[model samples]
Target: MYLKSIALVGFKSFGRKTELAFGSPIVAVVGPNGSGKSNVAEAFRFVLGEQSMKSMRSKRGEDLIWGGSPGLPRANRGAVRVVFDNADRLLDLDFKEVVIERVVYRDGQNEYLLNGTVVRLKDVIRLLAGANIGGSGYQIISQGEADRILNASPKERREMVEDALGLKLYQHKKAESERKLGETGVNIDKTKSLRRELAPHINFLRVQVEKIEKARELKEQLAAKLNEYLAREHAWISQEDARLSEEIRMHETELRKLSESVRAARGARGSSSDAALAGLQGKLAEREGKLAAARRESERLARELGRAEGALEANNVTVEAIVPVPHVRNFARELDATVSELERVDDIARVRSVLQDIRSRIKSFIEGLSGAAPVTNEEVKQQVKSLADSLARVREEETNLADELESLRKGIAEARESGFAAERDLVALEASVREAQSKLGGVRAARENIAEARRRFEEEVREGIALVGAAVHSWEKAEIPPGALSEERSVQEKRRRDIERLKIKIEESGSGSGEAVVKEFTQTKERDEFLAKELADLEASAASLKDIIAELEKTIDARFHEGLKLINEALKNFFTKLFGGGYVDIRFVASQEDTRIGGSLGRGARAYLYRTHFFDDAGESSALPRSRRDRRRAR
Candidate 1:
């Protein structure tokens, strides 16, 4: 590769765009001082990816931009581009010509471009290193820095010689490999530390997962036991329920039949007799009331008749006019008939009307007596006769009422006797009914006990389902063992106890978090495995980097020593030719102190060159030769 052209824009004194074309192998810029000759050389460094501002004769990036003159404006940025003729492909690019550019802004930001495409400073450095070119190398010697190689320390001079010999690429690769190896070592330590930290948690999760798995097993056992227990219990309860229902139905039917028998017995006995006797007793009471009223009327009529007789006997004076005897007899007969009708009339209204008619007739007869002329003795006799006949008729009615009352008393006595017998039979029938009701109540109470048992059984089923999940419903298809009904309840109780024990164990094991614990365990274990794999990969990469670093170091050392020998041979010839018959020699001397390489302690040596010149048997004097003591004293 060779220099083609360089372009500068807003760079230092080149405020406007500037281009320099180098068509020959050697080119020189002859300018007076302060005419940008140094700036042009610095632009080459800038475009080649120099990082230090002080090396470019500037304090900061903005100082590298052109400061305005009186007639020109200041630049906001500085850019430099170098084009290389790469027809020989020495630059590691496919193109015949390669352009590399760098731009620095006033804010101290920098941009790099390769062939018009943006790139990083590291990319530019790497690409340039392949062609044995670098920003700070012996290839671009400044005007006053011609003797820098002779004045530089052994290490710095070694680096400059290495750059000139085109070993900078190997040096860069070795340095990068060492840096990556250090980072890989740090990453390995971190990965191991992480694994150490994760160890206890992973173990804890393993224990939890084991516990959950055991709980799952116990739950499975509990579920199976529940299926059998629930199914058997349900079967027994159903059987009991049906049996109790049938017994209840039988008891109810018996109770109903007993009740009907009691009713039939009551009907077959003196149920109507009791009603007839009650009616006859009521009529007897009415007849007794009528007898008392008739006796009173009879007494009243006897008094009235005696009063009429006494009036006739005392007066002895006859009325001139007399009522006809037949009429008087007819009145007496009518009064008697009214009293009889009163006795026959059951209604009070009819009896009252009859009594009122008798009173009106008596009143009219007395009024006629007062109005009669003296017919006298005959009319008094007839009135006396009529009053006596009325008394007699009333007395007859009282006697008839007494006779009817006696018959009603006899009928009532017979009805009472019959009612006693019927009541005894009713009491016996009621006792039987009561006995049947007592039996029915006992059966109903037993049925209630069965119902309560069924309720309790259902409650147990619900509890089982809650504990073991809805899978308990699978119990419906479970078979009850033959003759399980004959098994003692204690057997079921034992089964229940077993179920409860399993449930307690399952709860203690925390089955509820089984799935989550398993998932977390799996994930944690996977993370640990992945980390382990990554750690192994990092260690392998670190090992590979170390190997590469060791190889590169070997190559660099070999090449450096070879280049030093060539340079010494050329220097010897040049010294002989330039000074005519004086001899100069350059050779390597190893340093003593240990050096750190790739974050490790190791032996390190740099070639320290000293020049010795001799003239005709005089001992040689060393130029720039220092022992360890002198070197230390210089430090």
Candidate 2:
């Protein structure tokens, strides 16, 4: 059988239903990472009964389920089902096709089904094994498993090749045969033990047969007594059951009447309930109206208070901005001094220029005296005098300029301080006005909030009033009241209790005073029946076991004879190949039990060897190795 198709539902990453079909001889699966292609291979393994979760790349069985992604909801369980085409009669039974399914739940539980009927994992494994198919079998080789044959030891490799040769059927049969042989041995031992145990009982029964015959008569007498007693008790129970049944009937009738009365009473009280509900509605409306009026009054008072505060804050700003006259006068004097100082600093530059010009003319006159010569004393002295006068005047002028520049700087510094203070006072006045305006805006907002709250309350009060009036009108039409229902329910409960008491009386009367005796008798009868059934089953098992033992003995004898026949034929072929001869030898040994005069069961072939000679190129006569006695003596 070959796999035809597999269907997956919520198994691994195949979140939705998916199906894969296989071609006759080859089916290739190719995919990128996480496309669930490997999961498809694993699905085959799962349905084939692979019990190792680790081999499947999962730490727990529930890991096989598809935990949904962000776009799809999670599934609670997973399923993988495989279909097989069995038309070639590869499987043990003849069927066109087979479908097997395996399901796993998040709770780490698994279920297996065959053709929609639940079955065990053992059944699935056996079915696949019959077809020479399994998780790691030759028919399905995964990419990584190719090296398994290379890595296997000699014995394991032999086993693998044997399985590929379709020897699994023979191996399974051999194992099953061995298991049956072992079980039969165990059963033989058990049966022998049972026979030993029954020996004393069998002997005892043989001795007690005569007494048992006498006891049978007494048993019949006891049975008659039991029947007589049971009949008397049955009559008393029947009479009691009848009386209780009649009382139960009377109670049932009364209960029905009381139930009808309750329905009528509840209908009559409907009008009163409606009226009471209407009054409550009216009261609720009145409270709502008072609440609305209070809110409106509070809002009006809030608005008036806000207006008054705004007017007061606005007037306060004007009074704070009035300045003192002395401050203004100080500012005017500082500005005047600054302008005068600016004029004095402008004249010192001209004086310094006249001094520099006088000095330069003196130096030019001295240098013009003569080409190679040192100056005469009188000329040198005259030049020195002119220079001294120019230098002395420049120094005096610079001293005067320095004193004037110092005074000007002092005046400018004082003016700057006064200007900064004036700027500060202006800024403070502007800030106070802004602060007052902010407070006025906030007060107005608060008043508006209160007015809105009052309006909402008024609307609710009007709606509540209308709701109460409508409810009152509805109540008048309803025709229902409350208390009558409670009274009628009490009467109904009494009738029900009466019915229950009558049922108890009927049941007790049937059971009667002889209940203890009857219970004991029934228990005894059940015990006897169980003992008899067990005895019958044990006798059947013992008989079947004898038949099985005889059959096994005959089969083993026949198989041993057949094995010797095959061994002889194989020996004949092997010898002819080794010896290059026309004649061959074959033999069968007598069974060990038949050779009771046992010397050491000697080592030699049972078949006597004989040789036939053939001619060489010249046709000469030749002698051949033959005769056990001649060969042994020569060695």
Instruction: Score every model by TM-score.
Output: 0.64, 0.33
> How would you encode candidate 2's per-residue C-alpha lDDT over 178-278 as one tens digit per residue?
45545655665665566566556555544444334333333333333323322322333343345445544554454455445445444433554445445
Clashing residue pairs in candidate 2, if any? 269-480, 269-481, 270-479, 270-480, 270-481, 271-479, 271-480
Question: Can you give the lDDT of residue 610 in candidate 2?
Answer: 25
Error of 2 at 446 (Å): 99
Name the lDDT value of residue 389 in candidate 2: 35
Clashing pairs in 1: 318-374, 318-376, 319-373, 319-374, 319-375, 319-376, 320-373, 320-374, 320-375, 321-373
In candidate 2 the C-alpha lDDT for residue 321 amounts to 32
The lDDT for every candidate, in the order shown, is 0.79, 0.50
